[model samples]
Target: MTPFSQNMVSVSLWITVVMLFGSLCDGGKILVVPVEGSHWVNMDILIKALHGQGHSIDVIRTFNSWFVKENSTYYNSITILNTSGMDEEFVEDMLFKMIDYERGKGQMNAIQLYLHVFKAIHKTHEMICQLITNIFESEDILKTLKEKQYDLMLTDPAWGAGILLAHELKLPMVYNVRWTTTGEGHFDIAPSPMSYIPVTGSGNTDKMNFFQRVKNAFSYLLMDIQNSRFNLPLYQSFCDKYFHPRVHYYELLQGADIWLMRVDFVFEFPRPTMPNIIYIGGFQCKPAKALPQDLEDFMQSSGEHGVIIMSLGTFISDLPDDFTAEIAAAFAQLPQKVIWRYTGKRPSTLGNNTLLVDWMPQNDLLGHPKTKAFIAHGGTNGVQEALYHGIPVVGIPFFFDQYDNLLRLQERGGAKILSIATLNKNTLHAAIQEVINEPSYRLSMQRLSHLHRDKPIKPLDSALFWIEFVMRHKGAAHLRTESYKLPWYSYYSVDVAVTLFAVILIFILSIFLAVRYLCVKCCSRKRKTE
Candidate 1:
C-alpha cells in the first residue's frame, strides 16, 4: 500500500480500537430518583446517553404521574413508590386547582405567588415524607440499596428527600435542574448576582431599573422567608428522623458532587458559574423529526400562511374556559393554522383555522418549515425549544419562573410577554401579529439558535462527559467550591463588612476626640491670656 493510504488505515484502526475500549470502560451503575414527572423529561438525554454507553440504570418514581410514563425498557430497573391518597385523578385535580388559582384569581405579586407555591410544596413534602417514612420504617430497602453499590446517584433536587436518600446510601449525587434552584436549598454553587439575575418569580430581566431591582431583591427575601417558614422546617423534621442529629439538610444538599444545570446562554442571560455546574441547557430536547401523517397534512395545507403552535405545558393545561375562548378567538383571526394543546372543554370561539388536540408534538411542530410562531406560557423548556427552533413567541406567562423566562425573551427581541390579567382577544391577536410580522424577533431567535448549535461538542455529549468525569474521579470533589463549607455570613462577606465598619468607627471616634482636645486647649489658653 502507498504511504498515505497506510497512515489513514492505521489512524482509522486506532480510532475504532479506542471507541471499543471506551464503551467497555463507560459501564457503571446509576440510580435516578425524580420526584416530579416533568423532571423525567429533563433527564431523557442524559439517561439515554448513559444507557447507550452501557451503564446499568435504575429509576424510582411515584405511581400515577402523568409526567412520567411507564417504560420498562428505558431503565434496567423501575421502582414505583406508592403513597396513599395519591392517584392520577387526585394529582390532576390538584394541578387544575393550582392552575385556576394562578391564572384566574391569583395576585401578580411575588409574595402572593410564593405563599401559594409554599402551600403546594408543603403538601408535596408531607406526602413525600410519608413515603420515605414508609420505605425506611418498613422493609430492608436500605439494605438492598447498600448492596447495589451504585457508582453515582442522579437526582432532581425539587425536594430535599433525594439528597438525604443519596447521603444515607453513601453515594455521591449529582443535581439536575430545569431552572436555577440553587438558593432554594437545592445546591450551593456560585450565586447569581441579584442585581442582574432575577429571582425565580420576579419577572424581571438581568438589566433592571432601580425599582425593578428593589422588587427583585424583595422577591429573594420573600423566598427566603417562605423556605425558612415552610420548607426548612419540614426538611428538618424529615432529617431528624432518618439521618444523624447533625446531618443538616442544607449540608446534605451541599454534599452533591456535580450540578447539571439546564442553562444555555442563548436563552439565559450571562451569569457567573462554577466548575461543577455544567450547562447542558437544550440537551433534553430531541432532534426535530418529520411530523406524523395527519399533522403533516394540516401543516402542508397552511402552505403560505404557515402554522402557530400553542402549548401551556403539562401542569397548567386546563385553563379557564373564558380565557381559552378569548385565546381561541385570537387564533381564529390569524391566517396561520393553529395547533392548540387543550385538555379541557373546547371553546365555542374556536374556528376552522384552529385544531385543538390533547397533545401536539411540540418539538416537531417548532422544527417544521411552515411553523411561524409559538404561543407559550413562558416555561423554561418551551422557551428553550422555541429558541432552539428559532421561532418567535407571544408569551402569556401565568406563574413561577415562566414570567422571568419570558422577560429574558422579551429583552432579547425573541418574544412579547403578555400578562394573563390584561389578556383579551384583541391583545392576544395583536401580540401574535407583532411577533409574526416583525422580522426582528425571528432574526434574533435565528441568531440564538445558530450560536447555540455552534459549540464544538454538542450539549448532550458535554453533559455525558461530565457525568462520566464525576464517575472517573470518584465524585470529582476537587471541582467543588469550598464556599459550601463557609457559613452564610462568611460566604457573603458579612463578617468582612462588619470588620470594615468597626475600623471606620474607631477612626472616626479618634478624629473627633483629637479635634475636641485641640479646641479645648485653644480655649483654655485664650481664657488664661484674658
Candidate 2:
C-alpha cells in the first residue's frame, strides 16, 4: 500500500472512534411536565439531577402550575403553555374557599369530600386539556418539541392531561407520584392488596380488625365508583377529542415505563410493589444547611426551650384567621418559640413569642438542632421532611392525604393527630405538649431518619441510575411488571379462586353421589334376601 492510502485509512478509523465516543457520552433529552402545586418537588429534583448528569432537559410550563413559578429556571429551556383564566389567584381563591367550607361547615362527609375534590380536580383537568390541545394545534410549540426529540416524558398522573400529552407525543413516559399513592392508580401499577396496604384516605392500618377491613374494602369500591362516574369520563372526553376517539383513559395512564413513587417503607406499610415502581421518598430532603440570619437569631433566642416550625404548605397556606388565632393562643402558652407560615390576616392574639412569615425554609428549619417539633398540615412533603430531619410532629391535617400521613406518623409514635375541624386552643396546646414532651416521639423520628439516610445509594443517584438505565437500554420495558398487562381478575388471582372453588364443589358432589349409590345397592340386596 502507498503512504498516502495508509494515512487516509488511519484518519477514517480515528473519525469513526470519535463519533462513537461522542454518541456514547450523550444522555438523551428529558421533558418534564410537572403536576399542579407542590407536587413538582419530585420532578424538579429529578430534572436538576438529570441536568447535572449531562442530559438536556426541557420543561412545559402551564400558567397555573406552581412548579413553573418555582423551578422553571433549572431546565435548559421552557415552553410556556397558557391556560387562560386559570391564574394562581383564581386557584388560590378556589382552594381556600373549599378548605374553609370543609373546615367550618363540617357538613361534608368523607364521600362528599371525595366528590368535591373530584369535581374541583375535574375542572382543573378541563382547563389543562384546553391548554394541551392548544399546544398540539400550534405548529411552533409542537415543532420545537419534535426538534428536541425528548427521549422520555416525566409527569405526575394526578391529572389525566399528562397522560394525554404523553400519548400524543408518542414517547416513553414515567409517572411520578409526589405522595405515597395517587388514590386510584394502585390498580394500574400493582395489586394494592386491601389485606394490608391501606387505600388513600381509607385511614385503615395494615392490622385492621374485621369491621375495619370491611370498611376499607367499601372505601376502595367507593373510590373506584367515583373515578368511573366522574373523573374518568371527564378525562376521556378530552382524551377522545385530542388523542384518539376510543382511548381507554385508564389504560393510557397505565402505559408508564416507570413509576417514581415518593414513598419509603419507614413511613408506609409493608405491601407489594412492582419492579418499575421505584421509591424515591427522601429526594425532596437535603442535608442540613445554614438558616438565614434572622432564622438563626430567632432559634438562638429560643435558647433552651427550642423552636417549633409551623406551616400548612402551599395548598392550605391560606387558613382562616380564626383558626390561626387559636394556634397563636396555643403558641403563646408554650415556652418554645413558634414560627408560623401564614398568608392570611395576622391572628388577633398574635403574641410576642410567635413569628408569622409568608414563607420560611421548612426543611432547613426542621434540620436545625434548636427545632424541637413541627406543627404541619400533614402534606406528604411536610411529613416526609419532618421524618427525614428526625423532628417529631404535631400534625393538624386539614384534608386529603394529610389525614392519612398524620395517621401513619401517629401509628409510628412520632406524631400526634389533631382534628383541624375541631381545633381549639386547648387541643392544640395539649397535642403540642404531648409531642414535645414525649421522648418516644423524638426517638422514633431519629430511628426512621437513620434508616432513610442509610441507603446503598442516595435517592438522587437511585433516580438518576434508573433513568439513565432506561436511556441506555432504550426504555427499561423489561423492568416493568406484567401486572399492568394482566386483566383485573387475573392480576388479583380471582380466576384461580374460582377454579379452586369449582374443584371443591365437584369433589363434594362426587362423594355425595357415591354414598347414595352404595346405599341404594345395599337396600336392593336386603329386599331380595327378604
Candidate 3:
C-alpha cells in the first residue's frame, strides 16, 4: 500500500476511537424526586456529588419554598424542577384558618382537637395525590424523559408515587429508606419502629415489670389495630392492582432489587436486616461551606460564650403556644446566645440574648466555628448534619422516626434525648449544658463524624455506582428474592404448620370416636339377639 493511504487509515481509526469514548462518557442522566422538607438537603448532596463524578442529575423538588426561599440560586449544572403545586404561603394560610377555628370559644379538648386535625390532614391526601399526578403528568417532565430517557431513578420510598413513576418509565429504581423499614416483628415492610404505633422496645422483653409489660402489650395492640384500620385496605388494594394475585407482604419487600437505608451500622445495631438493603448513613454530609453574611454577623455578635442553634424542623414550625413557651423559658436562662429558627410570630417576652429568625441555612450554621451545640427535633437529616459537623445535640423529639433517631444518638454518646411531653425549663437547660460542657459528648460526635466521612468513595459515588450497575445488568433480577412468590401462610410458615397439626389431631380424634361408636352398637345388637 502507498504511504498516503496508510496515514489516512490510521487517522480515521483514531477519530472513531475518540467518538466512541465520548459516547461512553455521556452514559445517561438520573432524575431524583425527594420528599418534603430537609430531605431535599440530602438529595442535593447526592446530586452535587454525582455531578462531580460526571453524571448528569436533574432534581424535581416537590416541596420547595418550605425548605428554601423562591429566589435562591442553584449551581449551573444542576437543574432544579420546582413542582410543589401549593407553596408555603398557601399552606401557612390554610393552617392559620384551621388554627383560628380551633381557638374559637367552646373548642374541644386536646385529644378531640388532635383527632380533628388528623381528619383534616387525612382529607388533604386527595389534594396531595392530585398534586403528585399533576407533576408526574406534566409535559415538561415527559418531554425531558422522552428526550434523555433516564437510566435510573432514585427517590424516598415514603413517596409511593415514585414507585408508579418507576413502573411507568420502565426504569430501574431504588428505594431510599431513611429509617427502619421493618414492622414490629421485623417481618413486615412498615415505615419504622419510631414512626409506627405500638412502639417496640426492650421493655417488652421477659425482664420488664408487670405494668411495663402491660403497657407495651397494649401499645403493640393499639398499633396493630391502627395499622389494620388505616393501611390494610390500601395495601390490599395496591397488591391487587400491582402485585401478582396473591403475594405476601414480606415477599413484596424482598422482591425489591435493592433497599438503601440511611442508617449507620455504628448505630442502629441489633437490627434484623435483609441482604438486599445497604446502610449508607451520613449521606447528607458535604464539604463545609461558609455561612451567609447576615448569619455570620449574628454569630459574631454571640461573643465568646458561643451560640446554641435551635431548629424544630420545617413541619412543626407552627407548634402549640404551650410548647413554644416552654422552649422560650428554657432559652431565657441559657448563657450562650440562642439562635432560634422560629417561623411563627415572635413571642412578646423573649430574652434579648435569643435571636429569632424566619429561616437559616442549617448546614452552613452548623459548620460555623462558633456554633457550640445543636438543639434539634432528631430528624435523620438533622442528626446527620449535626454529626457531620461534630456538634453535640440536645434532641427534643416529637413524633415519627425522631424517637428512634434520638435513641440511636444517645446510644452512641453523641447526643441526649429530651421528650417533648416532659420538656421543662430546668430539663432543657441541663440538656443544653450537658451537650455543650461535656467534652466526652463532643469527642464522641467528632469520632463518629470522622468515621462517617472516612469512606474512600463518597456516598454519591457509591449510589451512582449501584445505579449504573443496575442499568448495565438491565435490572438486578438476581437480587430480587423468591419470598414474594410465597403465600401468606407459607411465608410465615407458622400458620400453615399449625393448621396442619390441628387438622391431623382432629382427624385422629374423629377416627377413634367412630370406631368406638361402631363397637358399642355391635355389642348392643349381639346382646339383644342373645
Candidate 4:
C-alpha cells in the first residue's frame, strides 16, 4: 500500500483512458474495399479525407490489377490481392454460358434476357460469393484486419463480401452503392422528376417510354428470380457456416448500420430516401492535381479552343474498328485538341491534333483549367468527375447502368447523350461542338459543381464522421429500418388486397345476374301455364 505504488497505478489508468478517448474522438481505424474501377476513385478520396482528419485507414483493393499494371501507386498500408485471376475466369465462364444459352434458344427469346440473367448471377452469386470466401480464407488478410480492429468497414454494395466481413467482425458496416443499385431504387433512394425506369403503360407520372417500362419491370422480375434461385442459396450456405441458423439475405442488408449512396440530391431532385440511407453525392472528387507534362503541352498547343478528353472506360474498350474510325475522323476535324484513352491498337491516319494513350489520370485531366469538355461512356465515376470539375460531357453509354446514368446527366442539363449503336463521325462531331459551344450546358455543369463543392463538409469527411459516429455508439442499430424485412409486394403496396377486392366484385356481379335470370325464367313459365 505504498504511495509510490498507488501513483504508478493511477498513471497507468490515466494513460488507458486517454488512449480510448483519443480513439473515440480522433476517428478509429476504417477498412475500405471498393471492388471495381470507379469504386477506387471514391475510396481514394475517402481515405485522403480520413487521413486529413488523423484517422487510420487500410484499403483492401480486390480488383486493382485490372486498372494499374504496376505496383507504383498502391500505398504501403493498402493490401492489393490478385483478384483478377478469379474475376476473369468468372466473367469468361458466365459470358460463354450466356452465349451458349442464346445459341440454344435460337429465336425463342431475346438475347437481352440471357444477358440480364448472366449479369445478375455473375455479379451477385459467383463474384460476390467467391469474394466473401476468399476474404474469409485469406489468413493474412483476416489476421491484419483482426490486429487493426477497425471500428467500421465501408464497402461498395457490389462487393457483397464487405457485408459478410463486417458482420463477422462484429463491426458496423455501411453499404456504399456507388451507382444506382436499381433504376427504381435510384428513384426510391433519390427521387427525381428526371429519374425514369423504362416501364410499360404511361401517364404524365411515367418517365419511361412504353417498351422501356416493360423492360424495367421485366428486369426487376428477372432479378428477383435470379436472387431467389442463385444468390439466396449461396448466401444461406455462408450464413449457416459462419453465423446464426437460417439467416436471410434481407436480414444482412437490414443489419447494416447505414447505407451511403454516391449520388447528389441536387441532380437527383425529389429523392425518396429512408432514414438509414444518406445521399453523400459527389464523394468521388479529390483536390485538383496537376496534369501530366505531355498532356499539359498538348493542351497549350490547342490555344484558345481547349481539349476534349475521350474515354469509354476500362470494360467496354473493345470498340469495333468502324466506331474507332468514326471517332478518329471526328477528332481529326475538330479545332480543339483530342486526348483519347484507347485501350486497343491505335488507329491509322491519326490527326496532328489528336493524342492516343492507353490511359490518363482522369480526375487530374478533368481538374485541368484547359479541359473544356469530356466525352465519356457515362460511367458513374466519369460523370461525377465531369460534374465536380464543372466540365460538360458528351455521354455515349454502351451497356448496363451507363444508359440510366447518362439519362440523369442529360436531365440535369449538364451533359448530352449520343447513342452508341448509331455513332458516326458527324454525330460525334456535332455532339462535341454542341457541348463546347452551348453556354447553357457549361453553366448548368458549373452550377451543379458549385452545389457539389459547397456541402457543409466534403463527402469524404461526412463518410468518415459517420464511421466514427458508429464506433462511438458501438453500432447505430437505431438507424436500421424494418421496411427491408417486408416482402417486395408489401414494400411496393401491390399485395393481395387489390387481388381480393377484384375477385369479390366479380363474384358478386356474377351471382346477381344468375339470380335475376332464374327469376325471369320462373315468371315466364308461370304465365305460359296459366
Question: Which scores better on lDDT, 2 or 3?
Answer: 2
The lDDT per prediction is 0.76, 0.77, 0.64, 0.68
lDDT at residue 210 of model 1 (Cα atoms): 97
Best by TM-score: 1
lDDT of 1 at 77: 43
The C-alpha TM-scores of every prediction are 0.87, 0.86, 0.72, 0.76
Q: How far out, in Å, is residue 245 in model 4?
A: 2.6
Cα-based RMSD of candidate 4: 9.9
Off by over 4 Å in 3: 1-26, 57-114, 117-121, 131-148, 179-255, 292-304, 318-326, 421-426, 438-440, 443-457, 499-530
Question: Which TM-score value belongs to model 2?
Answer: 0.86
Instruction: Give the C-alpha miss distance for residue 72 in model 3, angstroms.
Output: 9.7
lDDT of 3 by residue, 12-101 (tens): 665566445532234557766555566656666665655654676665544443543333233222223544433455445444444444
Which segments of model 1 are wrong by more than 4 Å? 1-24, 77-114, 179-187, 500-530
Q: Which run of 10 residues does model 3 get worst, by summed lDDT?
A: 70-79
Tens-place lDDT digits, model 4, residues 1-530: 89977977886665566445543355567776665555655666666666655667666554534432233333324544544423444444443443334335333355665666555545545656766677778888777778878888877665456777777787788767644222233432322333353321121123566665566666656655655666567767887887765666556755677777777766553435677677777776776787778878887888899898988775554444555888898999999998999876577656888989887988888888889899998787788888889999998865456766777778879999887545678998999999999999999999988888875456655665576677678778887667667776886677777788889988998999999999999999999999
Error of 2 at 177 (Å): 1.7
Candidate 4, residue 493: Cα displacement in angstroms equals 6.5
**What lDDT is reached at residue 67 by model 2?**
46
